[model samples]
Target: MTDEASAPGKSTAPGKSTAPQASDQYVQSLARGLSVIRAFDAANPVMTLSEVAARTDLTRATARRFLHTLVELGYVRTDGKSFVLTAKVLQLGYSYLSALSLPQLAQPHLEDLSLALGESTSAAVLDGTDIFYVARVATRRIMTIGITVGTRFPAYATSMGRVLLAGLPQPRLEEYLAAAELHAITPRTVATRGELLAVLDKVRAQGWCLLDQELEVGLMSIAAPVWNHNAGDVVAAVNVSLQAQSVAAQADPAAYLESVRRHVVETARAISQDVSAKHGDA
Candidate 1:
């Protein structure tokens, strides 16, 4: 379920080093073991020992030791030559998801919206330059990529991402824009900083965002922010996704847009209210 190809290795940069300042404070071995766990993703679900070593930037002997340790711990399994993560690995992600009430609170709302509109609905929170989907209800497949809990996509190209990004303070937004890698994933993706800033401004003013074919060829989505009632901050975003071709099939595109936008906004507001009621500062 991990989206990361490999959890990043410690950087050589002075301020970014993961080395313990004091010998007793940090365990480099533990960090390397975690890196091995993060190396498996959808693209590389199963890997040879050498592949794991290459991905984690560890020596063959070191990587093999960690893999054997994980196998003994029941987090990984192997068939002589290739190793793959087992179902037990899900426990790690489940622990985090279980601690947060947001996913549970938003599930019913997402289900209802998906059932009512025949579209996919998802909720996500920003993580660095990516948006990780925590909860989702899929009515049908709309993209080549399959999205499930823990799935992630670039924030700059998604409707939900833009809504969350728009909620950031001006200085933070500028900092993100300056540092983010805005590669053009699709022909319509907003890759330039100027264009992204303009889009963020529109999202800020409208309190919602609509992205069309920016992430993939035919996918369209509308999203609204889920506000934290106690703190008055955007904590997550909710979105409804449909195929671009479906838009024209409706009796009126304008009416369809209005209805979808209204429902999505209402769904996000309901989730926010639920979170506020259940957990004061969540």
Candidate 2:
């Protein structure tokens, strides 16, 4: 069996990331191993050996080997005829949480932002072509779209992605842009390089960004970058999302945008000082 570094969206059954880069001799084994785990998804959480083999594109014997190895490691388990995930799988994501000290640090401020603004708030970092939601505080449960931990969305269409991207070095930002096209989730989604670059420039100059239903329809968002005080580097971004109806109900997009931006920026500053400080460089 071979595992490849899984890209975020493919088999992303809410698959946080399943796509991996092509492998050499050593990484080949690792890719096959991870691929075994990714074979499980929301639709097919448990599977027989052959199902796992088909899902992973591995031979039954190979899938069994990797699956057995994972079961041995406590990350995978067998329940009757099918294989399933174990609680230990959380450790992989938890490691990132513990290492970053982000979710714990940002929760309080994020909560405040959501409550005060009567909207949803989130924090995230770039993951290839997508924005991976790290922490979220949502005021409404029945939002237009469901967002859970590990949800990935097109960065080209989100406020948080743009603000964070604005802070990236020119060469890196251009590289990402060159590889990215404006995926129009809605008519509002910027579909060309020129428009996206222009919007990104505005995000940089104004210190905030507003995305109006570009990713998810009837949902508007605003975001601001959080920077490290010591390094002066933008580490991540915080965003506020409100229902499109609500935004329109208010009768002023610019005013609401400014308000949301302020809350996001202030919360981000708190996150930097309170959370980043705990890290060695913070």
Error at 45, model 2, angstroms: 6.2
Please write out the lDDT profile of model 1 over residues 84-116, one tens digit for every residue.
999999998888899988999999999998888
Pick out the ten consecutive residues of candidate 2 with the lowest summed lDDT. Answer: 1-10
TM-score of 2: 0.77
The model with the greatest TM-score is 1
In model 2, how large is the Cα lDDT of residue 86?
85
Q: What TM-score, over all chains together, does every model reach?
A: 0.85, 0.77
Candidate 1's C-alpha runs over 4 A off are 1-26
Which regions of candidate 2 are displaced past 4 Å? Answer: 1-25, 36-84, 142-145, 178-182, 251-254, 279-282
